[model samples]
Target chain A: MDTALSIGSAICLLLGSFLCLTGGIGILRFPDFYTRMHAVSVSETSAAGMILIGLMLQSPDGIVVIKLVMILLMVLFISPASSHALAQSAMRHGLKPWLSTTVPAIKNKHNETASDITSDKGVPPSNL
Target chain B: MIHTLYLSLTLAAFWLLNSGHYSPLILSLGAISIAFVVYLAHKMDVVDHEAQPVHLTLKLPGYYFWLTQQIILANISVVKHIWLGNKTITPTMTTVKSSQKTDMGKVIYANSITLTPGTIAVDLIGDQIIVHSLLSENIEALKAGEMDRRVRQLEH
Candidate 1:
């Protein structure tokens, strides 16, 4: 039983570390702020959840398990709300997203839905 | 009254679990603190169903199970895009309609959208949500209202 528990924990820890690494690389490689935020959410939700579950499994007693569960619940509930707020604030600041060519193509084909929202520049130069 | 009682019970449980002592002095202190908190909550007028959703206790486990599966699938999709390089990148912002009835339901729906890997819910105006996605496929799915239907069922 101990061996099975340890093995499961090891697997979960490894997977969590791998997901965090992927998210880090994504943050560095993605085009702009919104995409980077999305990448970070990958780490926040699944990666953090996997790591916490692994820790919970490795814990020996009920108190430790309860503490781990509390932490997990906080992460699951609070992280998404904060992310949504961040995205909303950014959008409210007039930071338009980089859309695909298809949106512009359709507009050009119709010539009626022509928008002032330009799509040429991939990402803003700097926000700082 | 029920909300206050439930809140106090929950606070007491949390206190007991956090404090490993069961002596008279410590127990009384814990009870006093819990009472003070309940009094404050009652004065603030924040003891409602959404604040203390005892009803969701039974429904949340199943919803969380389904959400976990969605999270895993989303992680896989996002990791693939991250590795495939930026030539395959396409970020789009669009608005989608929601069909939830209550404020809590709409908040849940929007948060679920943000919780998924590629999609972010930017703004919510009535039933419509402004969402930004790393992939068009994610947006297409949101626009289709499959997730909306599931969340509506959960809320109901």
Candidate 2:
């Protein structure tokens, strides 16, 4: 049982570290502020969650486990609130999201496929 | 009255968990601080249902479990797109109509949208949230309203 628990904790930690690394790469590679924020959000949510959960699993003390859970809850609640605030403020300041020129074509293709599916199902197309 | 009681309980629990030293002096200090803070909170008029959200305590765990699953899936997709590079990404912006009647519900919905990677809630005005997504399909998924429904369920 101890061995299994240790293995699970290790796996979670490793996965969390890997996700953090990818999120860092994403922050540097992605264009514009909003996409970069997405990268940060990715790291903030799952990576932190995984790491905290791993710690909780490894900790033998009840108080330590509760502390870790509290920290996890705080992160889960705060990260998104901060992200929303950042995005909202940035938007208010008129920072346009970078869009690819090819987006229209892909959007049209998606609409066509969606309409086709709806028509086949005998349902009217909802504004998508 | 119930909100104040819950707030004090939460604060007391938080203090106890953090301070392992069971000395009388430290315990008294913690008690005093907690009381002062709670008193200030009451004066500020923030100790209402919205602030405490005692009603959500029963339902939050299930919502959180579902949200965590969605977050994991979104992480995988966003990470895949990151490795796949720019040409594969289709950044799109769209407005999703939220059916949530309460401000708390709307906040939860917007936060859930932002919590999932590859999608960000850029702006929320009334019931319409302007979302920027890394992929158009993410926006499509938001439009499908599963998260909205879940958040609305939390409200009740």
Candidate 3:
């Protein structure tokens, strides 16, 4: 039972860590600030949740479980509020969203032509 | 009065769970702190249904479970799109109408949208929520009003 619990907890933690990595890559790769913030919510929700549940599973007793749960509750409640405020403020500040149409050059199939078009246009936002 | 009792018990339990140190001095200190906070809340006249939300205590767990499942599914979809890279990440904004009557209900609905991966509520202007989604499909889902309906159910 102990070994099973340990393995389960370990798997949860590893999955949590992988989710965090995905969120990190997403933040770097996603276009524009709003989408990046969307990526961040992934980190805040699923990644944070996975880690907290793993910890809760490892916690010894009732009080420890309660403490972990309370922390998770706090994160779940606070994260979205903070992220909403962040996106609202960014929108309020007149930042234009990088929508699909804002990026014009991704559909180009020819690699050399895409690179050539990108040269004077000062780099496409990211790769094709 | 009921809110006060519920709040105090919750506070005490939270303190006990958090403190993890149950000596006389620490316990008394924790009690004193809880008393002071509750007193402050009472003085501020904010300990009513909106503040305590004891009614929501039961409704929330069900909503949370559903939201968690959605979060996982959305997370997998988000990870897939991330690996697919930017072209497929068609970021779009849409405004969805919230039929929730109360402020708390609306806030919960908006937060649920923001909490889910691939979507974030950018602004809550009156009854309309301005949402930015990573995919066009997510926008359509938001337009479908499933989450909005769930939150309204919680409100009832």
Docking class of 3: acceptable
Best-matching candidate per lDDT: 2
Name the best candidate (by TM-score). Answer: 1
Residue B94 CA error for candidate 1 (Å)?
0.5
lDDT against the true structure, each candidate: 0.82, 0.83, 0.82
lDDT of 3 by residue, A83-122 (tens): 9899888877766566665434333233332233223322
lDDT of 2: 0.83
- Against the native complex, each candidate's DockQ, computed on alpha carbons, is 0.56, 0.35, 0.38
Question: Clash pairs of candidate 3?
Answer: none
Q: Please, what are the lDDT tens digits per residue for candidate 3 over residues B1-156?
A: 999999999899888878888899999999999999999999999999988898899888898889889988998999888888887777766567899999999988888898898899888777877778888889788888888899999997
Lowest lDDT 10-residue stretch of candidate 1 chain A: A105-114
Candidate 2: the clashing residue pairs are none
Writing each residue's lDDT as its tens digit, candidate 2 over A1-128 gives 99898999999999999999989999988877877888898899988988888888899889898889989989988998889888888877766666555445322232322222222221222321
The candidate that wins on DockQ is: 1
Tens digits of per-residue lDDT for model 1, A1-128: 99999999999999999999999998998877888888999999989988998998899899998888888888988988999889878766766666666443223222211232344434444552
Q: Candidate 2: deviation at residue B79, Å?
A: 0.9
Collision pairs in model 1: none
